[model samples]
Target: MTHYFSWLKNPDNRLKLLILAFVITLFPFVAVSFFAFPTTDDYCHTLAVKEMGYWGYQVHYWKTWSGRYIGTLISATQPLAYDSYLGYKLAPIVLILLYVHASLKFAGAITGDKLAKWQTYLLAFLLVFVLIAELPVVSGYFYWYTGYYYTVADIGTLYLLAYLFRNYSKLSSRNIVVLALGIILLVGMNEYTLVWLVVLSGALFFFGSVVTRKLQVKYLVLSAVALVFGVLSVTAPGNAARAESGLYPTPLKYNLLFSIKNSLAWQIHNFAKIAPALCVLALVLIPIACQLFKNKGDFKFLRAHPALSILVFVGCLYLSYFPSYWSIAEPPNLRGQCVITFWTLIGWTYNVFVLTFWALEKGYMKPVEPGKPVAWVVGLYFFFLFTGNFNYRSAWSDLLTGRAARFNKEMHERTALVLNTREEQVYVPKLKNVPYTILIVNDETDPAWASVEVNNGCAEWFFKKKFFYK
Candidate 1:
């Protein structure tokens, strides 16, 4: 057992290392998609997709619609309309990959060459943190299609912004252009990318810490350009109407804070649970604190590193506030915003703590190797649990309930019944299968399957010739 543990600690143990990394990367995804979670707003997005037909259409129409310009594009371009369950199902996967890519690259850039082998291990740990933080977001997607779109759009934009900043020194003209294109893609994700623009503009203050004055000016300029494009991308007449459909409600003070607290607490609790080893590591920090201050004066570069880290942490914290308001008044996308916020801070904190320990060991910071053992012990503990648990069916059951089963059965039966009805158009009140409008939009493929839902507590329907149910 001791030999096995020692082997993992060695950098040369590449196979075990690779396996652990792979498991951590893939495990949460297995649990997320298989449950087939669906929220109420998903029907709305599906219906919206059924209405729009291309990226251009979303861009054109969403200018007026305030909600999700990017999603409108995805919905428009999808060939199947509401029938493209496959595209809808894969949405989270696509966003998750983009997120992981941006986060890892950003962390690497910030830490630079000073990041040790053990600290490099923190990258994989950070991935695990992203997953655990993302659980509620994933769960939210199972019910509301629109929620999925909104959450992904917000997190994805924030990550892209961080990735750009972290790699500012290395960014070429090509990268900047690519970042510009990425911003356009974010248009299809949601209009709330606008919120990201606001948060990132505020982050300019932190840029001076890590970037030269010349480059900092350039970044602020590019951010302004992206902000203009983001706003314009959602300015179409049709989209404006739809977007205005969702407005900032008069927020109750308690509701806003409560929602934010719940979102934060969920992530923090999971962080403690899924990464119990981290708790142990936290406890051993008391003695390690003495060693951290010892390195306080020797390495001047260390001074910049902590300052940069604190900047990143504070920026993420402030950005978190806007998402809270949106979650309360509009679509309630706390899950994605919460994950992004929690992990941003955790990643920075992990780096700071690890560096403190490493510095202490080298007599640059402190005189203790006490926290070193704690870190190793905790890392190994996480590796075991993360690899061993593949089937979290119980967790899925708790989150998704029997909704998937019920939705499938009901949808199937309802479709068959709708086919046999004599009415040329049918309005199914409380019908939840692919929203009746999606079926009507694809009337050429299945002419017998037209349906629509009741609007605003009024169960009324207008057929080809007349109105019923006034």
Candidate 2:
């Protein structure tokens, strides 16, 4: 046992082990992506783009539906736009890789060379795994074509943050231009992310100027760019049209109060939902925290204002909820919750590291050593992840039990039927095997149901015939 522990202690060996675990953890999710199919909005947006032309579709959506210019453009050009099933299957894989790349970049930027490459990759992998595994709706953020743009935009934000954090003090004029362009695109992608970036930039300005007494012109300029674009997005004529449609009916006061209340409740719920994984993450971070503390000078600012930092973290969470509630007069939808889950996990992990380092600095806890404790915790994490976590377990079940395959076959059959049918109106049977990892909104027999009408309308637009579900 001691010999085995010694072997695992080698950094290279540890990286290899972690890489293997990451691949294993990610396999089922990626495998099942082959079975994914576009849902309601996917058909709608693709059809709209085809009918209006790409640029025309953007203008139409801007005038009628949403102010998310970049999001609308991306949605219009999804794999389905070109009628490519193979591309559709490949979309999730691309997204997963992009997320890992962004995470690694951000990790490296933040740690500089204080941590080895393996350590940076370890932290990045941990972040990616937690975000993917604990998402409130995996299909919404990953599989659904219309929704995954948000994830893309979020990843873009991460990359932008990494660039800024790495180059802020010595940004070239070219870098500034790149930063501005990135912010413009990011704000146009989604209102939720726009709000997030704005809040984050504001916090940076406050901390840098007020607390540290060091003014950063780059932060101020970026904040102004975000605010300007944010106003332009919010004030779009389509926003008022969307509001008048009675989609979001909650009053302003109620929206404000509920956003705050639900923000706290959801964070607590998510924490409990992934408690075991979090425990493992906390244990994993202990050694990393100790390394950071030893190599980097004391993170004095991080520890100096613990109370303020907690408030800032909670405030960020509240802001995440506020934009969705204010827009829709309700909590964010499952797709939007992807952002919530993301920030919560990130905030929680960072807090864990900071608290651990603080404790070590204060002599309240002994210095951490990566050995038996981390190994045991990792084993428990994998056990809980594969057997207990609904997200991963459901994914494995879908792939192993042939549910995903059956679902894929059925969808392909439906597509064939739709394409071959000559009738103006067609009746199709409901899907029998719906995979848990895929979003399936079963069509209602009653056409009066808004969902049924929308689904039938989009299908008719796409297939040139009405579809009825029985």
Candidate 3:
């Protein structure tokens, strides 16, 4: 691994290094997802798809009308939605690849020289770090459809922004179509993503126009269409229905100010969990990105004026979660955390890039000094900080995998019992660890167990019967 990283640092090699790093980072995510068994929400998502043929048009329309979560309903009813977790997960993996591809090209476009292979690898490192640090339940982000759409799919949309930024110059038919579709899908992912995407997209359009001294008509049109789709995404009739149908009570007035006010404390608390990582990223990644100081005085630019960097970073930190607190009724959930964390990463990256360019444009930077100990210290710090928080081995045990194993064993017994008797109530041990915050199974009110069978892959797999904690 040391040799590989050393070779990449040479800056002459093409981006082949990123492919290797990408695959390595992807391995455990795939492994955990592959073995991931369907949980409570997974069952409901499968049932939505299974029951699609049964729900009349009016009923479907009514459901969609009440709840504006078109993305959720669309993903829920997908034929491949609850297929092997690996298959369902391919979408986000492909998005990550697109991010790497586009980000490299975009950086190249900015500097008039293609980004070095190692830089791309650094981005891959940051992406994985963002994923592990911000997730409330790692498996749900990759494995469960509801969480997958809100978290992975939404983050994928954010990555696609890089692709758009890279290719926005072209007026090709393919680019137009892809951009439009991406906007709609992004809006569909959830409202928080919708708000942030629109803001970022609009800002990018404004900056591109100002920098080039020419209107980017394509991007302007793209931003306008994105805004339209965003409105449609949130106001979907189904959203209202879903909101009413949900067990949680809606506020009498739905005050936007109240939601924003109430969510600050929680979002602030969420930042506390990963502030160290964010600080490390702000300090280390910015200089590397600027390329002004490569060795001993690599951090001299930052060290010269520590307060300015902190002020800017603190601003980025607030802006990261600014759009997140608009839920208006309650605190944003885990998936909301996913969106906020992603935007935070994007905000940090964007801020660093801006800082680098400003420093270069104003000549407020130091000369590069080669063969310095500082580089080694920075490298060690990167390794230490990243390795400290991210633990794939620990994820296997902490994420309810053992409970899944136990759940599998109980299934064997449950199946045999059904074969021998027509019992109405099937007593089973309660699952101690459910992914996310949901109960393992809502047996008290939902007696049919039909949803369970669907998550198990249809009724024949396990006869329909009530299940309860022993």
Name the candidate that leads on lDDT: 2
lDDT of 3 by residue, 7-108 (tens): 856665535654655565455554434334444445454655555642443257445642234455545553334444344435445544554555455444
Q: What's the lDDT for candidate 1?
A: 0.47
> Each candidate: how many clashes?
30, 0, 17
Model 2, residue 468: C-alpha shift (Å): 2.3
Better candidate by lDDT, 1 or 3: 3
For all candidates in order, the CA lDDT equals 0.47, 0.75, 0.53
Taking the tens digit of each residue's C-alpha lDDT, what string does model 2 give over 1-470? 89988997799988898788778888887899888876666777787887789999988888887888788878887677888877768898888878888988977765554787678888888888888777888877888888876898878977986787577557787887888899889889887787777777677667767776888776688778888888888888887788777655657634666766766676566557767677778787778777777754534433434455567777877777766655665667778778767766666666776677678777888877878666676867766666767788888899999988998888788888878888877777677777777664444432211233545456566777777766
Model 1: CA > 4 A from native: 9-28, 31-39, 55-64, 75-82, 89-122, 141-145, 148-167, 183-198, 205-215, 230-312, 322-332, 339-364, 367-372, 376-470
What lDDT, from 0 to 1, does candidate 3 have? Answer: 0.53
Ranked by TM-score, the better of candidates 2 and 3 is 2
> Which scores greater on lDDT, model 1 or model 2?
2
lDDT for 216 (candidate 1): 62
All candidates: CA RMSD in angstroms? Answer: 8.4, 3.2, 6.8
User: For model 1, how does the per-residue alpha-carbon lDDT over 1-470 read when each residue is reduced to its tens digit?
Assistant: 99977886776574456546655555445434433333233444444444453454555544555445556544444323445556544655665555556555544544443444444445544444535433443344332344555556545654665566455556677776767677666754654445455445435534652464454655555576666765665454654364335444454422766656654554454445545444443444424344445544433323434455555554444444444443443323444454444444444444455556455656684355545566677657655544453323333343256434454455555445445556754544343433211111123222112223323211111112111221
